[model samples]
Target: MFSLPQRLAAEALGTGLLVATVVGSGIMASSLTQDTALALLGNTLPTGAILVVLITILAPISGAHFNPAVSLVFAFRRELSAQEAIMYALAQIVGGIVGTIAAHVMFALPLLDASTKIRTGGAQWFAEWVATFGLVFTILAALRFARASVPWLVGLYITAAYWFTASTSFANPAVAIARAFTNTFAGIRPADLPGFIAAQLLGALCALAFAGWLLREQSDATQPLNAEAKP
Candidate 1:
């Protein structure tokens, strides 16, 4: 078993890479492609692909929770301690910022800049709620019925969400916060972070509560997937 510190490190490292992939791919996509649809397609594929790989490889170590919303949900379910949940959120946020900086540096851009990408509105907030709800719901459902397929399920959900949601499915609070630091293709205005994060957290809690009821008949529905502090 990995130590708590080691697990934390895995969470941090995995989250860093996840955001790096997200921001980097967006930058590359907008840079290389003229068509908006093609640029979005470019952003979607690699993000989903890398998410699968990251989760699969890091799940055993840290549950591969690159999102504060997910961590909070797990904590609410008692799969992770309150302290651990707080630390995980912190780690993910820190990792996300580092990842943003890394992506900027790789693109020969400034290390830090506020995002001006306006992403605020009722529709956007609602989309975030839906996206995060589906994310947590998928995770809970998959662990019970299709443990082996969780990676792909999540990847596919996010891939689909990217297209379906106006917010491009930022389902992750840490990602939302980190993206606020950049003025790039994937960036979100810092002013928009509060609403997005609030929606995401609420969505996660709502999903866990609803999933508990929806999957009540299943024995594994209430089981803790992150019981060992890992998936």
Candidate 2:
């Protein structure tokens, strides 16, 4: 229903707001509490809530794909042109970075500080893979079976995944990259990015393949040729 440029703008705006919510909430939560679990809960809720809000409002415009991994999955399915997918990714990445800066400005912190927070190791990478895999699966399956519930499905999944996953579920590459620029409760070190991103991409692709198999419909050739004519 929206034009390409308008869709791109929606993507940039949605991703920017999503990242801002993530970083801002993390900063607020950490500042409010020294308890790690409590802080994480604070961060998790806002991220999930924002996803639901953003997706509901912006899905018609740009499919509300705030993550590059999600965008790539759509591109692979041929639901979006490869060139449009690339443009969406670029907008998301740029918007995410701007989001970090927005968060920092709100908190009176320095803009664009490289994160010192370290998040690395096999466990973290595996957690990211699992996290992203679940996310993509949820989206595809919901789109197939319960299209109206996608926003809630995704929101609830991330809310739960945040606590279950060891990495607190940095499932989105754009969000991860944005987090790398903040020295906050939600930040991951820049050096650790490659592994997380790689794991996320692999996980997303696997979900696409699995969903293709699992959600596929039986061929119409199996039905009698006169079935439609009878109706």
Candidate 3:
């Protein structure tokens, strides 16, 4: 088990890398292809792949909580200590900011301009909700039924989310915050942050509840057999 600070630091670093790769790739893809859909697919596919690989490599070390919502769910499940959860959430936020700054500097993208970024509104809000719900639910299911294969499952989930969800399934809080820093096609507005974050958090909570229910069913199904065997 890592110390609280160490785990938090790993989350921060991992989230930073995640944002940088996703956003930076989006920038490059947009420049290469003027088509919005193509650019999005080009950027997101590789980003999703990288996220799976990185999380698998880092999960045992730091739990790979690159999103605040994920950390909150873990805390709710009693899988993570409360103090560590708080620290991880804080680290994720800071890491998001840092990652955005790094992307801006490295890509020479404008940081303060609101017009250059992508944001949610109108139908986009519904999209965000759907995306987040899918993401959280998939993550929970993977943890329960496919913990040993989480990396591949997470990758496929994110990839599918990009296509199915209108907001492109930016389900990670760190990813969302980091995106706000760039004034590019991938950037999200600061004004819209609260609503999106709220939606994602709600989605996570709902997923957690669903996961609990499923676990209870599994436990109940197993208990009767165990009781019979004991007699």
Candidate 4:
């Protein structure tokens, strides 16, 4: 029973730390290695590990929705008011940028540089959609059946999505927007933001729709009986 302001604060703090981990790790990984695969592996693990830590600590306050897509999903599900969702998104976006700046400061890079990395195409767009869809679905399903396991579930899903998805699974709109501010290995070009955000939102909505139907609890009459159950 946290207040709205408290929840918003938690969201901001959690998102900030998440982005710091992402951008910082990316900068470090690239500096350490020339191998693309190894660099990606370096970027992937910290992001996933931080998700688990942030969600575990902050979920009680703000549902640990560090992603605009995740906040939007909760709004659609009627868990959060539309205004709350919007505020949460604003906090997350702002926090993410601040985190990026912090990462840059730590590495002595420019505080706010637009990314030059070119990351846009139909394949990547579709991959963003798939990545976000999987993320939201994992959250929804885990909440329904194993509420306590949501942290690990989401962390692991994003870790795997990073490897399997062509886009490295930016899956989070706030994160995607923040990453656009950095010119590091984790960054995406500012011009590519729109497509990624659009795909993420659409994927989240689709997951909401799919999970709604799939997670509905069946009545006893609708449940299938085991073959060994005697009449």
Of the candidates shown, which would achieve the greatest TM-score relative to the real structure? 4
Compose the digit string of candidate 3's lDDT tens values, residues 1-231.
777777878898888888778777887898899998899888878888888887888898888879888899999989888987888888988887787777677878665345345466766676776777677777788877889788787778888888888788888776787787677767888777777888888878888887778765544656656555754
**Candidate number with the higher TM-score (1 or 2):** 2
lDDT by residue (156-189, candidate 1, tens digit) is 9999999999899999999988899889889999
How do the predictions measure up, each by TM-score? Answer: 0.93, 0.94, 0.88, 0.95
- Which model, 2 or 3, shows the larger TM-score? 2
Over the stretch 1-231, how does candidate 2's per-residue lDDT look in tens digits?
889999989998999999999999999999999999999999999999999999999998889999999999999999999999999999999999999999999999999999999999999999999999999999999999999999999999999999999999989999999999999998999999999999999999999999999998879988658855855
What order do you get sorting by TM-score, best first? 4, 2, 1, 3
The clash numbers for all candidates, in the given order, read: 0, 0, 1, 0
- Those runs of model 3 whose alpha carbons end farther than 4 Å from true positions after fitting are 110-118, 218-231
Segments in model 1 whose C-alpha atoms lie over 4 Å from true places: 218-231
Ten contiguous residues minimizing lDDT sum, candidate 2: 222-231
| RMSD to the hidden true structure, all candidates | 7.6, 3.1, 3.0, 2.0
lDDT of 1 at 43: 91
Q: Model 3 reaches what TM-score against the true structure?
A: 0.88
Give the true-structure RMSD of model 3: 3.0
Model 3 per-residue lDDT at 126 = 68
